[model samples]
Target: MTTSATTNAAGVATERSSRRRGGLARPTGIPWILPALVVSVGVLYYCIGYTGYLSTLKWDGASPLQLQVGLENYARMFRDPIFWRALGNTALFYVVTFAVQVALGIVLACLLHSRLYLKTLYKVLIFVPVVLAPATTAPVFRQIYAPTGTLNTVLEGIGLGGLAQPWFSNGTFALFIIISVQIWQSTGVVFILYFAAIGQISPEVIEAARIDGAGDIRIITSIIWPSVRGTTIAIAILSAIGSLKTFDIPFLITSGGPTYATEFLGTRIYRISVQYSDVGLGAAFSIVLLLLAIGTAVLIQVGSRTREEKAGV
Candidate 1:
């Protein structure tokens, strides 16, 4: 009886000790993460604040002589035709790349999910482009689309030499190439996303749909597409953000133009800031870019939510 009483008291003390440890753990964790929080929130927000302040000044990146020009840089951006053209290009690029990549991704995802031969090899091949560096592949693509390159060689071999032209010589063609390159580069990511999303769908539901005389297209449209709508929304947001700040491919492939024909906001901001030394204008552009990205993400999310709410999902 004495031993039992003693054991009960010991158990109560251990429980109290654990409760004390649990209570202290969360407070102690803040100190451990304080350094990372400071670096991320403190240093990052400082740069953004500085950039906002600098946007009101007209100063060559190096010169100390500064003119205070409130919103003049922004006004100049509004009047700049190149800026509008870049904005238009971004819109078109987003539409084309997003549509093509999503469709291709969905198709590839379905195929990969099915019982196919050499599945691992096919996945690797499909994903290879996503892993490749744009800087390395840009030069290769430039050569291929050159006047005397593999594309032209293939065209001539097929007796379609008339269609063979220097693909980068024209603005239209350059824009097309940029869009195509973007679509090629990002499709794998979309495929993987859809693949994972589709995998989560209940197999029983699919089988039931098939037994109900639903064809492949019917099953895809009625069951699978709706199932992966969240993934599509996410891809839409990402594609919007990506298209807004696209630089590497267009810059590396064509240097933003045969005449600024393929310019995007990212490349334009870069050239303004570095090449022309228009730091104020560049800062303004950067601010606009940030706003647009955030706005787009919010819009897509809201639209998605509205649709989901209407559908009672």
Candidate 2:
């Protein structure tokens, strides 16, 4: 009986080993991934290749593709003063909006994530703006920023009528007003991201920190921030890219007006392509915008990697 049992056990072990080896040799999921890969490649090639081909031509939308002014459109774009101003505006929007949104988001996320009452209601209210369509929000804000609009009326009612200026008409304040509107609409996204990251942190770790007499600020700085560094980096990159490609609000609200004070590359591209009928110049602008976005994301990724490596993470 003992001999028979020993033989049966040996056979079972060998079968398990063989099954493990087979599983390792044949990886799964490749069949499911090929369709997604094909679709992504097709879309990328169609968009990028067509845009690049159009950039070298000097054809209006109605004309045949006969005139080939290689790189002249790009040259013209670089020499245009409006282009420089738009670029500067894009950078400013990215920097200021990104800083304010992230800071406000972090604060809000921490508050909501804590043991505060009515957390669910606070989260719903904060996140409501994110789900609203831009079409709806843009027009509402336009009216609110109008001379005799809700904002001005409120300011007058509060006995601060002097503080209420033409929010969208003045070149000096148009960009800042637009920036504030963007922050108001999008800060909820950043808050949710940080909130999710904060939730992933171990409760035991936080409890231990509290036991060691670490105050709330110190705990956040020393533990929470480091733990969510990856999320912060991702949000930063996303905010920068979104700011660079900002179009709808600025275009719809101001039409890049008040003497083109709020013009960005996105609006500029639209004006060149659709309004001015200069397809080639618009294509060149699109290419430049694409390159700028890619370069910024790459730089951020490299910086992140360098920091991680230096810290032995």
Candidate 3:
């Protein structure tokens, strides 16, 4: 009997020890995420830190990186009038595009949400641009905006020939035209996002508001806006970042000309680095663009958080 009891106690202790060892061998959340963490750090260092290092050196593409300028590129960039003009253009583009897109998106979403004829067809038509490649669309727009292109033809056909000018050739109109094309291509994305956001809202709540004798404007202002505020904020930030980094359309169309009228940071960087063989200056410009984008995003997030806090959200 004594021997059997001792054997049973030994067996229990061994079982407990094995369980503890198994627990130690099992992976935790940190171990599972370590690979992702390593990759992210490597990418961030290579992209951001390496770019920063390049910005401090005066090196062309084919030559050795020998000249250490130490912020001279940034100093020259700030002193250049072209840089300021590009910055202004970028700011204007973001403000106008963001405001128009948001307003148009909300209006379209609301309209499509209502009982309308051929709603599905309307949605498909509006969303077609979102799926189309920018490379495909930019060339088409370039042709349309040419001196004797479809836009001029339409103006002449409608007896508005006086309003038609050399769209891409004129400095005054080139930036506006680029902004319009950007808006045309990207508004659909914003509209779809807002439409989906609105769809997620509770239908019963809206019906309750209607039953309580709330007007359409009141219902929208008090209910719809509050519910979709987060979506609106997100789209606003994205639009700002995209506008700041705008390149494809403006580059493919105007090439940042009629006399640098449509010059933005993205195009400027390419021109400086590839066209002029000033990689260091280009790196500095890139860093500035990165900072601008980060700043804009941070500002929007802070503003949204503050608004939410004040509203008791």
Best by TM-score: 1
Best by lDDT: 1
Predicted structure 3, TM vs. truth: 0.90
User: Candidate 2 residues 106-209, lDDT tens each?
Assistant: 88988887889999999999999889888888888889889999999999999999999888779868898788889988999999999999999998999999
| lDDT by residue (tens digit), candidate 1, 30-97 | 78999999998889988889899889999998998989999999999999999999999999999999
Which of the two candidates, 1 or 2, achieves a greater lDDT against the reference?
1
lDDT of 1 at 263: 95
lDDT of 1 at 213: 93
* Model 3, total clashes: 0
Off by over 4 Å in 3: 1-21
Model 1 regions lying over 4 Å from their true place? 1-28
Which pairs in model 3 have colliding backbones? none
Candidate 3: residue 59 lDDT (0-100): 90
Candidate 2 local Cα displacement, residue 230, angstroms? 0.1
Query: How well does candidate 1 match the true structure, expressed as C-alpha RMSD?
Result: 3.0
